[model samples]
Target chain A: MVIAAIGIAAAAALWRRDGAPAVGAALYHAWELFLFIAPSLLAGLLLAAALRQLVSPGALARWMGAESGWFGLAVATLAGALTPGGPMAAFPLVLVLAGAGADRGALVAYILSWALNGFQKLLVYEMPLLGPDFAIMRTLVTLPMPMIAGYIARRLPIAWEPPK
Target chain B: MTGGQVFLAVIALVAFGFCLRRGPGSARRAVVDTGQGLWKILPIFAVALPMAAFLAELIPADAAVAWIGPESGVSGVVVASFAGGLMPGGPFVTFPLVLAFAKAGAGVPQMAALITGWSIFALHRIITWEYPILGWRFVAIRLIAAAPLPIVAGLLAEAVVAVLPIGLGRP
Candidate 1:
């Protein structure tokens, strides 16, 4: 609602300066963009939804908690990439997995992977808005990041003794 | 439609089919989830897409280039990374804002850094969820561990752009 209001105000300001035509031009461009992205957007949402249903959070958490070392990080990274929804979904699962004895390094890897490589975010938002080329390039660069970060976290001297 | 778009569609269909094979209830749930997601995003898209268009016009190309263009190099990536961390809202807001920056001629590496920063730093998420549920120790370690990623991603993007013929065209 706030964003829409701000957009309207901006449009009105543009209209006053550029005479209605500028606002019209912006609208036209927006509509063109909408048409361009609509198909992919729908498809992406479907993919996200299907993926979410296919993989249960319980199974994922169990998988993460059971692994350790480099392989654990890899599994956590994969789980993070596969996890669906936003913070609400991912964070709770993270908490559960952590409480269930998931490795600290693996958890870091999981969070990083969720942030950087989650297919839901990539497909539903990134590819549609940023285009596939940029998305692909970014994804390629990001693929190795979670494991690297997780490995570093494991080496970090600071211990995570959970609040009692 | 672009190949990317077609590829997305095919994947979506296959995934949906897989869910259906698993059970009708799961397929129904997927459909419901998709509808809910659409409902959530549509209004935001209505405003954001146009906002991106106007922003493309309003943002000075020279400023964008000076701040985060290909010529701006490592410093540009650093600046973009911080800016991205500060950007409020979810993917719906962030991606459109990135689109505006891209249209205004921001560098590919800079944008890559920006997105990475947004994803990892995620101050809002950390404060809201991570701190409360995971405790301060966990948050600190996560932040420290992931600190270098955005810069790395930016440099990697720059290298890729140099090697590849393909470009990140303005959407």
Candidate 2:
């Protein structure tokens, strides 16, 4: 609210100063941001649904339920790969991961990484859009983020009790 | 599309259901009937493409960088995150938006951060789609957890670039 108010105020001020209309750069930016985000959401939803139907959750949990370690991290990442989309992408997978015995911390790890990248999304959307170089570079760097995320989730200091 | 391939997809899906099956599988039955294959899912993506195109018309690339670029790191991170969170659509246009920032002298940090912001952190989707289905608790958890993803993704991406075998150094 504060930022928007300031933005509007700045635009108003500028409009008053110059002979132009009150529309300003901030408003334009706000508009741009909105336009840019729409299509992918649609695509992600489509893919997410496909994923849910493809993989069964209980089996996925068994796979992901490997002993917690770096090995655990690999399992989570691979589970994420086999699973499609993020939390809201598909219903069954996310629910299965949550309900079918995937630990909360590991689920978080999977989700954070899963939500970010995967085969279909990267192969079709990102790698093509950003190009192979960008995709590969991003993959190399992000490979570690999930591990870090998974590690942090396991070592969580925050006191939220795990759901029974 | 071929009969054999359809046979394979079906076989794979059935195998998947039998092995890892949980949640709605017994009820839903089979791979072709799985979550992604439903007819109900295409509307959002179609809607998103036009909306994004219309939006980009308003905010040019130079301007986005000015507001969310790395010159102001903390503010940059926050703004980029929110911008991403606020959108109701796809990263298709956001990709160009990131490029726009980079073209306008935005740092790799800002571009990467903006991309992170754009991913799954969207606010409109959360409100309309996720909230009703999952409730506020999960929604809130996702939002709070995703808050810094953009910054972290950006910083780490930069770290990778700096140390790439090709290296980021001048020739």
Candidate 3:
């Protein structure tokens, strides 16, 4: 609501300066882009929600627990990529993993993987606007990043202070 | 639309069918979840997309190129990475702005850095989601571990662009 209001104000200001035609053109382009994106967004959200429901937290913990090692990190990364929704879905799962005794390394890998290479976001948003080449290149380049970060986090003795 | 779009559609369909086979209840729940997600995202789209278009209109192509285009070099990537982290909003907002930047002549490496920074270091997400849920210690460690990523990714992307043919950078 706030963002929309600010946008409206900005558009009105732009309209005053650039006149009606330019603003109209901009709006038309936005609508066109929206039309192209809506289906994919709907589809991606559906898939993400279904997957979220299907993958139980207990199962996630078992796969990514402290003793699970390198395989755990790999599984966590893959799961992070596949697990859908935004931070609301993700952070909760992180909490669940933490509570269920998942390894810190696996947790770090999971979050980083989701942040960098969320498959659903790529499918729905990135591929459409940025083109497949950019998307593919970005994906390939960032693929190993989470594991690298995970290993570093694992090696570092950063104190895990519990939340208030 | 594009091959990627078609591929995603097919994947969504398969997933939908699988959800249905699991049970009618699960399918219905998924649909409900989708609706809620759409509700949350649509307003951000409404604001961000038009704003992106407006930004493209306001910022001249030459200025965009000079600042973040192919010749802008490492500094451009650094600027883009920081700008991306500072950008507030989700994928619906950020990706459209990225498209706007691309249209206005930002380079592939810059865009790569932008996305990388947005994913890992977005301050808004860190304050709201990461800190509250995961605690400060976890957030700090993750930030330190991930700090070099965007710069590294940007440099690697630059190297790739140098090796590839002319049009490969755009599409």
Candidate 4:
């Protein structure tokens, strides 16, 4: 809602500043982007949905249920990148992992991995919007982050309790 | 369509085939899920693209370059990372805004830092999603552990761009 309002305001401002022609040009460019991106966006979403079905929550819990060491962290990170969708899809899996006895480090890795470079976001947004070069570079740079953070998180004195 | 688009379509098809093996029911569900997801986000896309375009127009390219261009270096990356953490909303909102910044001449490394910051430690997500569900103890540890990631990612991206023979940071 707020985003819509802000967008409207921006459009209005642009119109006022440079008249209809500038606004028209902006719209034209936006339209062009939309056209160029629409096919990939639809394919990416379909791919995400299909992949989600393939990796069921129960399977995910079983895979990460045990092991709190570096291997566990690596698996957790891979799972996070593979898990599709936004927070609504990913966070519940975190809950499931916690419930299934995944450690704090693994959980942290999962969240960080998803947040940083979840395949769904990469395919749907980054690749189409920023191009493959940018996406691949960003992914490579941040790829090690989840494990590194998870390793540190594992050493923390904090205790873990699954959310009720 | 570009090679990327073709690649995406081929992957989607292969995945759909796998889902079909699971059962026609599962295959249908995947399509239904995609439809629903598209319905939800299409409006955001419509708004975001125009908003990005207008904002790109509104913010002068010279200012963007001065603040986050290739010449701006580590300090610029640090500033971008901080700004990224403060950005609100989801991918729909953030990615379009990033695109706008890119169009306005933000550097690749700076944009990388911005995205890493947004992903790693988005304050809004932590408040709305993490703190409430995961509790403060978990949040504290996670934040401390991940704190340096954005800047690190930025610097790493810069180094990669420098080292690679291919032009890796153009976007």
Give every collision pair in model 3.
none
lDDT value, residue A116 of candidate 2: 63
lDDT of 4 at B90: 85
DockQ of 2: 0.12
Q: Write the per-residue lDDT of candidate 2 for residues A19-87, one digit (tens) a residue.
A: 343244434544443344323333333344445455543465665542666766666666665555434
Error of 1 at B39 (Å): 2.2
Q: Which of 2 and 4 is the better model by DockQ?
A: 4
Steric clash count of candidate 1: 0
Give residue A84's error in model 1 in angstroms. Answer: 1.6
Writing each residue's lDDT as its tens digit, candidate 4 over B103-170 gives 78788899999999999888998898898889999999999899999999999999987886222212
State the local distance difference test value for candidate 2.
0.50
Q: Write the per-residue lDDT of candidate 1 for residues B69-161, one digit (tens) a residue.
A: 988999999999889888877887788888888878789999999999999998888889889988888888998999988998998898898
Candidate 4 — which residues are off by over 4 angstroms?
A62-67, B163-171
lDDT tens readout by residue for model 3, A1-164: 54566567768877888999988998998888788767667766676677765665346667777678788888888877866768888888887777777777888888989988887687656765676667778888888888788877877778884343
List lDDT for all candidates, in order.
0.84, 0.50, 0.78, 0.84
Rate residue A73 of model 2 by lDDT: 63
The complex in candidate 4 yields a DockQ of 0.64
TM-score of each predicted structure versus truth: 0.93, 0.56, 0.86, 0.92
Instruction: Give the per-residue lDDT of model 2 (tens digit) for B1-171.
Output: 223223334544455545344555443543344344334333432333233233333345566556765455656656665666554444444554444345454555555556566655766556665566546655555555556667776667666556653211011
Per-residue lDDT of model 1, residues A42-158, tens digit only? 999999999989886446555554347777788888889998878999888887778767878888999889988788889888988887778888998999899988998888888
Clashing pairs in 4: none
lDDT of 2 at A139: 62
RMSD score of candidate 4 (Å): 2.3
